[model samples]
Target chain A: MTMLEVLDVSGLVTFQDSGRRGWQSYGVPLSGPMDWFAHRAANSMLNNSTDAVVIEIGLGEAMFRAKRDCVLAVTGTGFEVVNYIWTFPLWTSFYVRAGWRVQVKKISGGNWAYLGVAGGFEAQSMLGSKSTYLRGGLGSAIRAGDILEAGKPARELAKLTARNFPVEKFMNYSQSPVIEVIAGPQQDRFTEEGVQTFYGSEYTLSKSFDRMGYRLELLPSPSSAKGIAQATSADLLSEGMTLGSIQVPDNGQPIVMMADSPATGGYPKIANVIRADLPLLAQCEAGVSKIQFREIMLEEAQENFQKLNKAFKTPKG
Target chain B: MLKPLGDSALLVQLGDEINPALNQRVHALNALLQNPIHGILETVPAYSTLLIHYDPLTLTFDQAAHWVRDKMTQLDDSFHRTPRRLEVPVRYGNASGPDLETVAVSKGISPADVIRIHSEREYTVYMMGFTPGFPYMGTLDERLIMPRIATPRTLVKAGTVAIAASQTGIYPLDSPGGWHLIGWTPLKLFDPTSETPFLFSPGDVVKFIPLESLESNSLLFDQ
Candidate 1:
């Protein structure tokens, strides 16, 4: 087996896969990579399982040296890759020879990035996942001087160099995104005018956002409701809440659920972001980014979901 | 009435209010749905709703909805036996419970009286969430009702007991929280290494015993 030792690490970096499922009943949130689509794409390129453990880096650089020759792919917005004195853009698959030092510079585009090695990284799987949950203290992030073992033996020099690893074509990370949503269990909780405003006005992403939820600042409603007494906050019976459910607390600001969100919540959910758009929202750049929701029918949402699933199931060369 | 929470989940709601009857119904339905039933992946019981999450591929939304609706009709006929009860000991007030005075003042009672009232009642574990091992025990004595802190504390010690809005829970791990602290327990509510991580499951009965009983029991067990 080949191994990679971390010389230095920056920001919050952790080993994540598709996430641990079937444990929500135990009150464990499904904590995994924020961008599932990008993670899957990187895995597809390597012909590995989508749930393979990869290093999820957020805002910082790291230096790693391969003990044996290996094939790996780096996917995200952009991670600066330094090969000797040469620096190159990330998000593409490349081969690293044994004993070669690979350094990632500061993040260029997205807040989080994924680095997938062929055959995946090996770690202790708690509840069948190597994903780290910082809130539950389940798994800690990768740190300096940590040695990680790769699953399979490294390829020979000639075989490794001959392998062609290219980046997969995907949506642009820098574009302004529109997330589609379906009206929710509590859409009626908000005033009719408030509902109209929610779909009509553009809200800005707030600084107080995290893996738990993204808080959006309220924008002026074009058809604002006046003099309607705030509905008494109901003592909701906690229920199973999923990622992308938009919860509107008493302040009327919406908080979009994320991968690490709690299993249940008391706040009323006005809408749920469609499955196809959740990945786009996960890769959204922070700070004052406007969000507009377009109402989508359930049938249409399911159709899009099936299409994405079909795309994911197709064998990639 | 149950509503489709999303394409993958359905929320079966009993009532808007948190009545004891509604809670019992939720728990009963949760137990029935625990078995490997068709189209059901997991059944999560809460204060008044039971959320059933299923895979859309195996079970269509319409089929799952109909199955749940059929189950709801049988809820009234089913009989529930008394649940197993566990007595949990606690060291109340002082450092363990910083909000003891505040809770007492709001209830117009002495701190000692507050402890008496809390210990006298047996609570039901409504659900386990918010944090792992943080059991949402419900039906707290009306006098114990208190609002959560204006600003949540950055860190609350593990085993720190707290109460808020007719509910009581113990902090399973040291994490940021806002519930009014009332006591501490030595017993670990959650251990990830255990086959069953959580000590108490939904619908289990919980009674609070004093620290003196805990010490006496420990000595007896040692002998």
Candidate 2:
């Protein structure tokens, strides 16, 4: 069996697939990679399927050593990585000599990164997901001294070696982008001014951002009299929540729910960041990542999401 | 009413409040749509709303809305199906129940009376959320209803029986909560290794049986 030994790890690192599906009724959360685009890119570089298992490296830094000759890809923001003696780059796959170390070093920009080895990481599947959901006690995080295993590569090691994925073809993380939203299910709970305050203002991604949700603090407008986005209703009845739900509590700071958010919540959701923009939002570094919101129709959101899926059909050079 | 939740899901509001009648309707609708409807990926039934998850490429929001509407027409609003009833054994009013005396005092009753009133009537499983298998059982006798403590405890232990507002809940895992602690159960509500991890589903029925003292049920852990 193909394998890699975890030599060192900092922060939280876990194996995630395309999330657990079809189990919300029993109160199970949909746990998966924080950044889907980067996770998939790491998989695509090695000709693996979109849902193939990959390592999600979160927070400070992590390091791993290949126990056997294999192929691997690294993607995501914030950290500079060192693959063996080479000054490595992100978004590309390369062959690994047995016993070489691929160290994820320096958090200069983002929070999470993906390391997709040849084939996929093999972990005990719980409820049909290889994803590690710490809250549910499902799968565990990868730790130092732990031996991680993977299935043999799908193709010849020679053919899978050195596959390059261009950064320009993907959602570029360099620019400060306008994340789009469709009005949330509980939009009626807020006044027109409340909706405006959400759409017309800049918000900073606060430190509370995680796989559960990205908490956004509304920046004060230039004119103080514009007013805050307070909900007309005091306490909302708890209801089912979707991925990317922008729930505003009493403080009026919007918390955009992510892949592992609870199935149900009580806060009045003003809007939902469209599915097409979740990956971009997920890649944003806490405190450092500044974002703005744009309201778009549901049809347009759906179209943009389809376009994104289509673009990932093949990464451009 | 059909509400849009991003590009992937639709929230179907069947009723306005958290009434049992409303919840039954939600569960009925939940049962109908759960049987492998084309494009409908999953149905999450809450207190008064049913959330439908779908594949965007196969079904648009409008298409899912239309399909749900079509399914609604066929649902029996008076739907009453036999539910799985579970009896949970709990040890009340000691170290297990930190707020048992306070709850009884607030209601002008003795701690034992509080236990009797709580264990008397069976409650309905309104929803399962906040954690795995933490059944949100409700309709506590109005006489027993008490406000949740002002400050939520940072960490409540697993299998703790707690009461807040009008619902009774069991802590399946160690989670931060605000409910008044009244007892604890040895039986695990979330047994991960079992084929059925959760002890209750959304539409199930549950009753709490008072235990005199702690009993060893160590087989329920470290699976």
Runs with alpha carbons beyond 4 Å of true place in candidate 1: A78-82, A85-91, A106-108, A153-174, A219-235, B37-39, B217-223
Summing lDDT over every window of 10 consecutive residues in candidate 2 chain A, give the lowest-scoring window.
A222-231
Comparing to the true complex, what docking class would candidate 1 get?
medium
Question: Model 1, residue B50: what's the lDDT?
Answer: 80
Give the true-structure RMSD of model 2: 2.7
Tens digit of lDDT per residue, candidate 2, span A119-160?
Answer: 888888888888999998998888998988888777887888
Which 10 residues in a row give candidate 1 chain A its minimum summed lDDT?
A156-165
TM-score of each: 0.90, 0.95
* Residue pairs clashing, model 2: A78-A109, A78-A110, A184-A271
Best by lDDT: 2
| Model 2 stretches with alpha carbons more than 4 Å out | A223-228, A314-317, B213-223
lDDT of 1 by residue, B137-172 (tens): 878998999888899999999998899988999999
